[model samples]
Target: MVNRVEITEAAAAVVARLEAQHGPLMFHQSGGCCDGSAPMCYPAGDFRVGPQDVPLGEIAGCRFYIGAAQFDYWRHTQLIIDVVPGRGSGFSLEAPEGVRFLTRSRVFTDDEVTELAARGEPERAG
Candidate 1:
């Protein structure tokens, strides 16, 4: 099964800004060290959803995707995502320490979300 992911206020603001300047907002997760996953924001049509795709709801009017591999590691982790602005319309996520981003996306499965939820970290929908 698959479930929709949620975004936060800071993330929403970042998405809005990106859309205002660029067009749409895109997020990805890829393999990495430590937690083995990292988050990345991309220009529209710049990313591909891998097997670990998780629907992290929408920011502004765009969908956010996280790879399954990253989700697996963060399933039960107290993961928080924040959108930080760079120069111009550039923005990225501010994940808690100990969390590594994938720099690509793999999408998340429903089972993964459920399992991660079961581990006890509340998903923030702001």
Candidate 2:
């Protein structure tokens, strides 16, 4: 099945380095505003996944989530997780690594949207 989220090779390498330092991880797409909407990486269970969030998919062996409201806005697109030079949010694990987890997106085509609509939102990760 086509995934709604994916990670670039560079980001995967970063994930590897992070996992070596911190173990299994997770990601939360910022809810915008103060955090500036950067995707934040955290050690698994560090960030709580509640009803307000929806699981998009996994990337670099990590679970990913988007706020329900943000998911409503982005349901038509696919998210591409990447790494860029620079520090990210202070709370994100990658911040100390001198790189940030960036989110790039593309709108889904009609057919892809139809398929996704049929599948519905993925079940939230436990």
Candidate 3:
């Protein structure tokens, strides 16, 4: 199956570091502007996942999610989670590490899209 999201090695390393400090972690991508658009990392369960959120599979042992509206806009693409050297939103746990999580994406090919469709809609957050 094609994963809706994946993480780069650098991002995975960062996640490992964060996990060592925070225990478990999760990510939420909102449809708001600016920092809200950036994937927000939190200590798992710190940020509540609402019923409207779409679970986009896991990256580096962390569950990734996107708001329903955001999922509608990005359903055809694969989200790539990356880490860059810079201060991210203060709201995200990584902001203290001087590196922020970023969302990079690529549109799925026809075959991948078809495969995803056949697999059925992803489960939504409850």
Candidate 4:
């Protein structure tokens, strides 16, 4: 099955460092005004996953979610998480690390979309 979300090697290395410092980690992309679609990382269970959140997949051993509305907008694309040099939202755990988690994307190909469709709708968060 084609993964809906993935992380870059640089981002994965950052995730490893964050995991070591903060234990388990999780990510949410809300597409909200405050963060402007930036991917926010948090200690696992710290950021409550709303019922309207869709689980895209795991990235670097962390579960990644997107708001249901955002999912609808990005459903045809693959989310690529990468770490960039800068400070992000104060609420995101990566803020203090002098880097931020960013969500990059690429449109899915016809075959990949077909494969994803065969896999069925993604499960929603509780």
Candidate 5:
């Protein structure tokens, strides 16, 4: 199956460091002004993944989630999480590590869309 999310090598390096410090992690990308648009990372269980979130697979050994509404807007694309060298404007765990998480995306191909449709629950909470 095609993953909805993946991490870049640079981001994975940062994730390794963060994992050594903070242990297991999770990611949530929400939508709104400011920090909401940035992917937020936290120690696993620190952030709640309720029913309104879509499980978009993992990046760097961490599960990635998107708010249901946010997923609606981004569902057609694959999320590629990367690290940029700067403190984030929000409270993601990596924010303290002098790097911020950013997302790059590409629209899915026709076949992936068809597979996703067949899955039917691709956008549902896990």
Candidate 6:
């Protein structure tokens, strides 16, 4: 059975406002140098949930779709979803769109944690 990702108050506000016009919220993980991970809330039907090759628990009324490639990349991720007031109204639908960055997993590889610490970066909590 699918379970929803924990949502933050800030995230809930964003989701509620968007749901009024669009459909459910959606979050997906992608590979990249920037952000290391990307959390996007897409209009329902804009993308399919997938073939279940990846692990995607639900969050609020949306689904956090983790791609197979991405899931394998961050096998130790403990991601969480939270609501935050969007930049502003109509912000959610603006062209190029608005994506709320949710929290990340607390667990990390020895190399990942070391890299963050070496860079003097704050570690994320579970």
What Cα-based lDDT does every candidate model obtain? Answer: 0.51, 0.88, 0.93, 0.92, 0.89, 0.54
Clash count per candidate: 27, 0, 0, 0, 0, 13
TM-scores for the candidates: 0.51, 0.93, 0.97, 0.96, 0.93, 0.58
Q: Which is the leading candidate under lDDT?
A: 3
Worst 10 residues of 3 by lDDT: 88-97
Pairwise TM-score winner, candidates 1 and 2: 2
Candidate 3 — which residues are off by over 4 angstroms? Answer: none
Q: Which window of ten consecutive residues has the lowest lDDT sum in model 6?
A: 88-97
Ranking by lDDT: 3, 4, 5, 2, 6, 1
lDDT of 1: 0.51
Off by over 4 Å in 1: 1-4, 34-37, 77-79, 84-126
Local accuracy of candidate 5 as per-residue lDDT tens digits, 47-95: 9888898888988889899999889999899999999988878779888
If both were scored by TM-score, which would come out higher, candidate 1 or candidate 4? 4
Assess candidate 1 and give its TM-score to the true structure.
0.51
Please list the residue runs of candidate 6 whose C-alpha ends up more than 4 Å from where it truly belongs after superposition: 1-4, 49-53, 83-99, 108-126
Instruction: List, residue by residue over 52-118, the lDDT tens digit for candidate 1.
Output: 4765555456666666655566554333445443322123432322222222223456677577556
Question: Would you list the clashing residue pairs of candidate 3?
Answer: none
Residue range 1-126, candidate 3, lDDT tens digits: 789999999999999999999899999999999887999999999999999999999999999999999999999999999999999665898898999999999999999999999999988997
For model 4, how does the per-residue alpha-carbon lDDT over 1-126 read when each residue is reduced to its tens digit?
A: 789999999999999999999999999999787566899888999999989999999999999999999999999999999999988765888888899988899999999999999999998997
Residue 57 error, candidate 3, Å: 0.4
Q: Write the per-residue lDDT of candidate 6 for residues 87-117, one digit (tens) a residue.
A: 3232224222354555555566577655544
